[model samples]
Target: MWTIGLGFVAVLVIYFTYWLNKWSNPRCNGVLPPGSMGLPLIGETLQLIVPSYSLDLHPFIKKRAQRYGPIFRTSVAGRPIVISVDPEFNHYIVKQEGKLVELWYMDSFSSLFSMEGESRTTALGVIHKYVRSIILDHFGTEPLKEKLLPQIEVFVSKTLETWSTQSSVEVKHAASIMVFDFSTKSIMFSYDAEKSPMKLSEKLINVAGGFMSFPLNIPGFAYHKSLKDQKEALTMLRKIVKEKMNSPGKHEDMLDQAINNMNKEKFLSEDFLIRWVFGISFATFEAISTALSLALKLIADNPAVLQELTAERKAILKARKNRNSILTWEEYKSMTFTLQVINEVFRIANVSPGLLPKALKDVKFKGYTIPSGWTIMIANSVLQLNSNTYKDPLAFNPWRWKDLDPSVLSKNFMPFGGGIRQCAGAEYTKTFMAIFVHVLVTKYRWTRLKGGNIARSPLLGFTDGLHIRITKKSS
Candidate 1:
């Protein structure tokens, strides 16, 4: 009996050792970058998700980059992942979309979109380009100068007016709802809580951080609630799409653009169209709202930056013949400092920390090989937070961008991402944030009331909500 028990214990030890070796070793033809894969199935997932108190990049990426260098290997949630903080490599990877690599989202992130069936793999590349082209037609630079700019300005002004009247407001929650209301119009139709009973925005609020969370669909987890919230939002979105299809009028939003092209484009099927609209709406809302919220917190905390920002906005308004007149393309263009502020905010905010692209085949970079079926996280946030590039990397200093132009989308500072697959809404996001800061500084003043804590569950957000009491400036 003693001999049998000892033999069983020895077998268990051997099994554990064997599995540990497999997890640590990369299954590749060539050498792999150095980094720990952590425990077997879990594989550093908990460490990756563990929040860092600082506003800088997550400690998981930072410490690994420090110890293992810019490009490192690790397994995240049972998936082998190569994290690249090297700008040159990230640029190469993103540009290689459809060739050496392809667009990839984790199960948790992809589940939120609910775009299953044929749209999953082969058609993904084509669908991405198709949606990008149409969205550009409606929300691109030309559209901004002609129409969307004024629309955004009006919506922001009216929305802030409403906010100023309230006692205290959560910047993130209020901005999410307001931005959702505004962007959803361009995607489908107008969203008015009073006019429509659908709680799509509210559902989406729950969907925010859940996309980047671990792909656990079990109850009592954020991933589960996120998927549930996404389903609810999709149902309402589909209902709206069907109703729109029944109508003869052209709304001129993204849905109308898609519907008009259904015959011209085979990929714009009803299913894909619905999912695409949901995606665009979320992109526009999330990117702008998160940045806007973060910008306010930074500006509020840094009085000098706030003073300069206020001066820039005041100067823009002063140059106008009528202060009440709508902001012009030329005036928007002249907002050099304001644009710098936006860039700096994005750099610090790290709104979109992780950009995942999967390896299509064995690809060699430097001395290491990235095996096919592995995911590469362009940990741009890690790169952005590098002290070598930006002085006082963690501090909010828009003036640092004085010599460096923020307008040029480079590998070094891509809050909206970079390369061919860079966010199609890049221009739209910058425009929205620029105008948002302009309106914020010139028209109103705000005080932080409560809840300023922040975190990144792989998605950066105000953990307790950035609550602030905003009021209109006195005449």
Candidate 2:
């Protein structure tokens, strides 16, 4: 009887070993990257949830990449996630011929965007194609140079007028309003700043950002509040769309164009349009505001850089005969140092710290097998600050752009992400950030307020509000 019992125990041990091996191995044929995933079922969820995770992930991913090579798997939310940091791997993932992977986690964004049914899956793709085409047609560089610059100048002037009177101001809040107004007017061709439909739209964005972490709606929870907020936001958007549809004026703005010129095959419903517009607005606001705050903080800390940029701006303005007008896109693009500064800011700020991609099939890499149904995260924080890609990765050196080949920079840069799902607002965002930085540096001189540390905000932007004392620069 004792011999039989020992043999059974040995059999059980063998079965458990087989199961563990299956669980730990990557399914795909390629090399799997290396990383330690904490205890069972929980994975890295706790580490990711902590506010300091952004800062922590950089070092952790870098160490893993050094040990594991480009692609690796670790557990997240009770599932295995393959993280890819190699430029070649990233290119393969992003630039694949067709839909590489379905963005399942983006389902969370569906609730935020108020997309339902099939619309949720396809809304982002439709909006991307539509907005890119329309924006290029209407608000392209030439038009922005000729028409939008004047509009921006007027808007900036109005903003300065109001801000000049305030003793102390929250820069992020103020910048948020400014970007919101600019984006709304630019997209809708409306200048009714106070009564603009974008006010509630902005609130919807806030709700979306805050709602993601809350438990699923079981009634009377934070998720419920987000659902309610989302409904209110959609109602406002619908009202605006209905008003635009009824008005018979030649459709000049994006809203009108979307409603009038939609491709039946890919055309979005009116409700989809409303939610997309809001989504786009929020994305624009978040990217631009965070970029602006970072720029401000950088300028405040590096007086010499600020002086150089200011001098460059002065020289450019002087060469243009002191026009005292907003810089056109052409003019903005010519500000090479400004571009470098913004790029550096993005590198350090590292917004959109990671990309979540769901696996469609079992894929193997680096001796590990990542099974299907597992969600993969490409941690940008790891790649952006990797010493192999960036020298003095922590320092804010705008001139680093000058040192590297443009091709290398493009390949290594994960700021806007890569692949088919790259940020749709990349060009618009760059333009907005350039305009914002130019205006702030040229119009005002600011110093960081004593006892203020500009830390990462809990909301994925700068946390400290970037308090600075501003004194108008003498013309």
Candidate 3:
């Protein structure tokens, strides 16, 4: 009996070893990039989500890039992924979106944003374009030149004024309130903070914490909690949709615009609308808010940078017709240094992980063959934080952007992502951040009271919370 048991244990060990390496995608025919596939099922996912408290690239990708060169392969939760930090290869992957790759996200992201079966297949092409077109119609340049510009200015001005009245404010929560309050007016037609819609926006924040985590539905996992929170959010959004469907005219907000287009676009289902709004809500609030948090901390920590930024902002105000006049589109366009400051903030904030695409066909890059159906992770943080690309990449130096070639900068800097599927709200975000810096530097000053420690679970967030006391700048 003892001999039999020993033989069985040996067989089990052999099988485990075989199974562990089996998911490594041997079909790549030894051309897979150098890296470990990690353990079975979970793979290198846990390592990917390991928290790093800094403004640079997360250690997971940084260490892997150092170990295995710019491009490497690893399994993320049993899903084989090719993570390309090579800027050249990243540029290639992004431009080849429709041809070599297609947009994709891990299950964590897919469950929240992806449409199902026919809807997804249909949405990826024309439906996606339609959505972008609608967004552009409302948020595009023409609108900015006319109305949205002044609207955003007033909203931000009042919001910051309110913040000044508070004893102290948490930057993250404060930003959430401001972004949502404005976003609702444009996107949701109207917003009441006490209403379920605004409250639901908060739920999306927790959901994003699990975005890069390993997908596991088990109760304690962040991914599971994310799904739970997402479901609740969708439920609330669903109720809002139903209410709007029954009682609404063609409302003037983005949500109503999409809803009204339902008959013309067959793929625009109730479910799809809920997911889209959920996605937009998540996008509109989280990215800008986290950026504000980081930007404020960076400014507070660097007085010299703040002084220069303040001078730049004052110049914009100086050019205005009068002190009481609002910002003009032309004035906003002239904020050269302010734009640089915003660029540096995004470079360090690194809110986006990168573009996620799936290999449409086996494609070769730098002598390695990426197997068809594999996930491609173009890590923007890796490129943005490269020592060769920027001097002292870890420091918050806005001055670094001054001398760079626009063409070269375009290649390296991709805070809004790239290619055909680049975020439609790029200008909106840039404009928002630009105006935010303008207001913060020119109209008000803030001091960090407590808790501004930075950290990232591959998802950028503050440790305790960035609390600040805001005061109006004395004339």
Candidate 4:
């Protein structure tokens, strides 16, 4: 009887080993990146999803990259995810010919943007290409030179006029409002300071960071509140779009341009128009606001750098001989210090830590296999902070760009991202930053508050609402 029991146990152990070997081995083209899926169903979810898990994923990813080399598989939210750090592999995933990547946490945006129409899943590649072209054409460098900069100056003048009456103010919230106004004016062409229902939109974006990690959207939960806010924001956006469409000439904004230029065969549906407006508007608002806040905070912390930038702007303005004149693309490009400042801000602040790229088929690298249907995150945070790429990565040094070769700088710097789906608003963003910085530094003198540590919260924008006392600088 004992021998019989031992024999049964031996057979069971052999079967288990065989099953484990089959499950662990790379299959389906056998070229997938190497890494473990761990246990079934709940792989790596615990490690990646903890609430206090650092948003700066460098330490974790760097260790993994060192351990597994370049490509490695792990689980995130019960889904197998591959992480690639090799620049070549990254280029392939981001730019080279391959399958289109899906936004894994798309529900987060759907909740925030209230995207509740036909799934974009089926037509993602087509939609991505079309939207990219539209944004690049309208919000590109030339368009900003002709249209956006003038609008930005007007907004800044108006915002400063209102702030001049107040003794002391929070620049972060004000910056957010500035970005919101800019986005609305640039995209929708009309905005009422008191009438626009943007609080819901703000709330939805705030909570969007929390979705996909928690199953809290089941009513009475924080995620549920986020969903509600998202719906409300969407309703507001829809109303605004419909009104603008029906009213015709109430305002001449991006919406007007889009309506005029939209291909009937491509963006035919009003629903698509609404989504485009909302998506672009939200992304622009968040990125610009955060960037501006970081720039301001850095300026306050490093007054010497700020003075240097101001001097350069003064030189540029002197050469142009018109403070009131709008800057052309050529003129804007001439201010290299302004570009350096913006680049430095992006490096230190590092907003939108990374991007998730999905696998189309099993791909191999460094003897590892990343199976298809898995998600991978190219961690920009790690790349930006990598010691090998940038000297003193944490230092807010704008002069770092002065001596660097342009070609080398381009490879190392990826604030807006890289590849085919890189930021459509890259040029517009740089131009906006230049104008904003030029205006603010030339006009205002700001002092950091006592005991304030600008480095404590570096996620871009005023997570704490930058409260600075400002005085008009004497001419």
Query: For each candidate, what TM-score against the reference?
Result: 0.90, 0.79, 0.91, 0.79
- Clashes by residue pair, model 3: none
Candidate 4 Cα RMSD after full superposition onto the native fold (Å): 5.7
Every candidate's CA RMSD: 3.5, 5.7, 3.1, 5.7
Q: Which predicted model would earn the best TM-score?
A: 3
Worst 10 residues of 2 by lDDT: 450-459
Q: Residue-wise lDDT of candidate 2 within 253-349, one digit each (tens)? A: 7787777764442445665677667776676677677677767876778877888898878877887855675565567778999889888888887
Q: What TM-score number comes out for model 1? A: 0.90
- What's the lDDT for all of these models? 0.80, 0.66, 0.81, 0.66
Candidate 3 wrong stretches, greater than 4 Å: 1-7, 24-26, 105-123, 213-221
> Clash number for model 1?
0
**Least accurate stretch of 10 residues (summed lDDT) in model 3?**
105-114
Model 3, range 1-475, lDDT digits (tens) per residue? 9999999999999998787667665567438888888877778888887788887788888889899999988888788888889999999888886577778632223343444555433445666578789888877888788898888888889899989999999999879768876776777764466664447667777787678777989999988999999998888888878877776677488888877888777667787777778878888888999898998898888989888887887777676678768888988898888888888989888898887889878888878899888899899988788777788888888888878778877778888888777888888888988888887788898988999988787879888999999999888
Q: What lDDT is obtained when candidate 2 is compared to the true structure?
A: 0.66
Stronger candidate by lDDT (1 vs 3): 3
In model 4, which residue pairs have backbone atoms overlapping below 3 Å? 31-363, 31-364, 32-368, 32-369, 32-370, 33-368, 33-369, 33-370, 34-368, 34-369
Model 2, residue 416: distance off in Å is 2.2
Per-residue lDDT of model 1, residues 1-475, tens digit only: 9999999999999999887887789678999888888888888988888776678778888788889998999988899999998888988888887777776632223343434455444455656677778878888899899998999999899988999899989888888888888777777764556587767788888898677677788999999999998998888878777877777367467787777777766556666666766776777788788888888888888999889888888888788889889988898999898888888888888887768888878889999999988988998887677787777898889888877644433768877777777787888889988888888788899999987777875668777889999888885
